[model samples]
Target chain A: MSALLDVQSLRVRFRSLGMLRALVTRTPDPFIDAVCDVSFHMRRGETLGLVGESGSGKSTIARTVMGLTPAHAGSVRFAGDELIGLSSRDYKAYRRDMTMMFQDPVGSLSPRLTVRSLITEPLRIHGIKDRNRRAEAKRLLEMVGLGEDFAQRFPHQLSGGQARRVGVARALALGPKVIIADEPTAGLDVSVQGEVLNLLARLQEELGIAMLVITHNLNVVRHITDRMAIMYLGRFVEQGPTEEIFHRPRHPYTEALLSANPQPDPDAQLARIEIKGEVPSLMNRPQGCEFHTRCPYAREHCRQVAPGVSHAGEGHVYTCHYPLNT
Target chain B: MTQASATQPIEAPAGAVLLEVRGLSLDFGSSRGRVRALRDVSVSVPRGRIVGVVGESGCGKSTLAFAIIRLLAENAMITAGEVRLEGRDLLTLTPRQMRDIRGRRVSMIFQDPMTSLNRVLSVGQHMIDIQYRDKISQADKRRRAAEALTRVGIADAESRLRDFPHQFSGGMRQRICIAMALLVEPALLLADEPTTALDATMEVQIVGLLKALQGELGCSILFVSHHLGTVAELCDDVVVMYAGEVVERGSVRDIFKRPGHPYTQALLECDPGRIHEKTRHLPTIPGSLPDLVEVPQGCIFKDRCPHAFERCQRERPPHYPVAEGHTASCHLLDETRGNHS
Candidate 1:
């Protein structure tokens, strides 16, 4: 069977403001590669995590997959149906099977809609019956661990974790085959974060849905994701099993990301693999390897030539001149 | 209460007490009723040490930070308690006394550095404005500003000072705010989620910078954050707040190794990095934070605590000793020991 969601060579770029200014001055077009030649696929009932720092083009990939943002190039096939450049009318089928959850629950939800109406709004759009929709909304709320009494509560009335649950319920309203949750547990208390994460995991199991969880949090990724992809400068630097990647990350960028997570143990050492500088501006991405600028193992070859993707092991792919934990 | 054992790795900073808070209670006046933000909360920061106030949002961690500096909202009432800085009570201080003590003595660093630092002002002017009332000449002020910026690891500080706040990155802007807070050598720094807005890598850098600066400047820090890992790495002491009250307080080593309070225990378990291997479901505290406007008198965390019993519902348990210098205000602890005294 075809993978639940197959994305091949997703290349998304936005014309930099410099490009616009260049038009006025008649200079070369300056394009920022928000997502460049990234390819990954996920099967039904599996989760693929997209992990990156801010400006790493992780969010852009999520938005593009949701069809909220137009992709400049590449194919996004959901269950063998092309999602890229589909007509508005044609997108309806794609839309119903795919829904997104945002980082900020309050911002994602409308102030005007009560919990019941907000959750049922997706069903209403898809033309589900009013009575059945209300019943489904209540079920959705219960599924996310909220009581039916919460149906009357407005977005403002809900706590951060509660609001996030409401967001989850709304995402589930349409029975989407694929759910894209961006920083699903961000800004919640660590305890509350566990609640949301558990809810998502439980839902994923019960519904047997494909999910793409985009987050900067490695902990979030390690807990729920089956397969994971690490993004740097709008490209997938590594893709592998969640356990394999966490235990033995082959890329230097992944090493930095893993080390950045402060261990709660007082005795844990925090050497912090010194990645030299910030994620560079998209306006002028470094030539050759995007990570070469901050990579600790960089040599003469790295600065001049980018390395091809190297298959490290079973279901593991990494692009590094000198891979670690061989 | 007994002190944490010497075997514990992270020792408590030995600096003299810089700020002491006792029974601090605050309520926000509203049409419905007073929203109790803080309730009988107390915390103390020793000189050149970091005391982390950690909790869920609306758990009164930030309110406690604001209360420490006596800079709560206009509608916020200091209903009870004393906030003493260097042996002087700030709660009873007149507006004039507070004005002199605020930036020069006990300054605060908020979550968003851009909001706290003026957008219009150049990085240099941000520091210069902190010393606006000083009798020092312009040259001295400029020199001090340059030195402060340099101390914060801002390279080529003198030249970079001319750049506006927008010119600096999020991490650098926060560093500038830290520099501004340190301009007058404040005794206590109230840093509330200072690195929350920055990326993970940037947070590591900022925390490292703060640790180094705290060492050099000998300033006490009431470092507030929701991230337990950050607290564990940077703080000497950690105070876990639930609802509006201080649920647990102890040295980092004591709290992390032996969390007396259920809330503390839950927080530790909830922390992602603590688990080395993959687990199916995370242990979550069942219920949500209680409504502050109508707080129940018993235990605030009673609804969520796994070990909560009938006594938790009926009576408000006072802070019980768990270990030397470690305490938890939980009925479970009170019952487990069989010694309320």
Candidate 2:
């Protein structure tokens, strides 16, 4: 299988001024690594769920893939083509093959524009100048389970679910091969979240598009994802098949995440693994493993040396010194 | 189901039924017309018991909280209801009487701590202001503020109290809000989605803190949230609301095990974990919430219910007893023809 999207050793850093006369002197700019040495691959028709807490640099990786933010070091390849070094003209053309869906649907969709104009704006921007643009927009809306009448209504007129459908329609306007959705159903109700996930699943099956779903909800990954990756502080702690990772989780962080999630069952009787303390700031990340600070099974070596990725099984890799159950 | 010894009431020392809401209904009146926000909603929070009001957005959970505090906006009116706290009907209280009761007897912690806490004032000032109104000495108020902050697990409570709200993180700001709500030691604490903005680990920590506080203070809590799983873990009783009406009311165990209402079942099935073991795709309750202005004459969930019958569309279903204390308002429960009344 050919990789549709590939990122290697991606790094993003932002510079901040130091305290005391640095603002006046304009010197000693401190750099914070938002994304550090992150790598992943997406194959066609595959869904890769990126699970992480806040400040985990998941959104940074998404933005870097979309070319909204430049990587400090590493390569981004799409279909064997290097997208990192693409010129502005070529990047614009490359962007037509990829799109992103934001977390907040209402914020992403312009309140002033009707559903038709919002969906068709991408087509118009890509120079698809034709009278059939409106008809194509209506079709896109219908495909997303909205009626043609919604095309004439503004964003404020639509509900949260309807707004998300519109966002999906806009992302599919150019028929991109890879779609990156960031927290697609975070604030939605449980029933609506299921609907959105089902919609994404059906769309992926029908369109044969690769998807990168970034979310904090572990249940979502277990339901819709083919493969999953656990991220903490701009690093992939574990990545593997969804079933294997859920059933036989190797990393302690992964185990804690699963345990922290409240299952619907009343009699499950699962051990509650409570993670103590707050997530360290990216500016001052801990030495060795980023998760060593919170791992319940951390040893002396776990805090002194960063663990490298080791293969646990077929297509399963985890970065932990002492994997659970040996 | 293993029932707790009914004879030996699970009681909190110094505990009593703090708040009892009966037939509460609220309406938002605009220049054009009136919109019914709540319809015949009733709930009770016993002292020291954590009663979780679970529902999705626009289910009138927050409105119920605001109405209890008499904090509803001018455009909104309590059409019909009685809000009683400790044998006193809050609905009959004037603004001045409500002011005396607001912090001393009943206090609310809103969802967004960042917005709820005054940004311009320091955390200590906010606590001091809340305490000073109760006629406590300034030194005693400061001591109580520090103690309250320490109770919520805020380290360096004395020094941190001098900092402004912006200086605290999201979770820390919430802790400060919790401290403010606890400073008065109110009989009933209304927490409106207190953990929604927090991370999973922080949420657990805050909920644990709340549980500890409930154990020590013996204050009843009306916890409003959209997550049923959280309610299952933390609450003693659960009220499932849909479109501003109570669809199901029962103990957490009974509700999770055998949900009678179709909406309750659909809500349970909508969760991925419940359906994870099955081979079928996840089931969704189809359609959105009904428009409040034009509420359906029958069941509000009939539009999305899979088991909707002719009667469900023509008449509202009355509450049917399912268990010792479990009740559901659904026509499916009526099929047995056994009425608890």
lDDT of 1 at A7: 94
Interface C-alpha root-mean-square deviation of candidate 2: 2.0
Note each model's CA RMSD in angstroms.
3.7, 4.4
The stretch of ten residues in a row with the least summed lDDT in candidate 1 chain B is: B1-10
Cα lDDT tens digits for candidate 2, B23-115: 788899976578888887778777778888888889999998999999989999887768888878899998999999999999989899999
Candidate 2 error regions (>4 Å): A18-29, B1-15, B134-137, B278-280, B335-341
Query: Who wins the DockQ comparison?
Result: 1
In Å, residue B64's CA in model 2 sits off its true spot by: 0.8
Docking class of 1: medium
Q: Which tens-of-lDDT digit does each residue in B1-341 have in candidate 1?
A: 12222111122345677787777779999988999988877787777788898888888899898877777789999877778788898988898999899998988899999898888878877778789889999889999999988888787989998999887889889999998888878999999999999888888888988999999988889999988788889998988888888888899898999999888888888877788778868877776678889989677888888777777887777788788778888777654556432
Q: Give the TM-score of candidate 2.
A: 0.94
Top-lDDT candidate index: 1
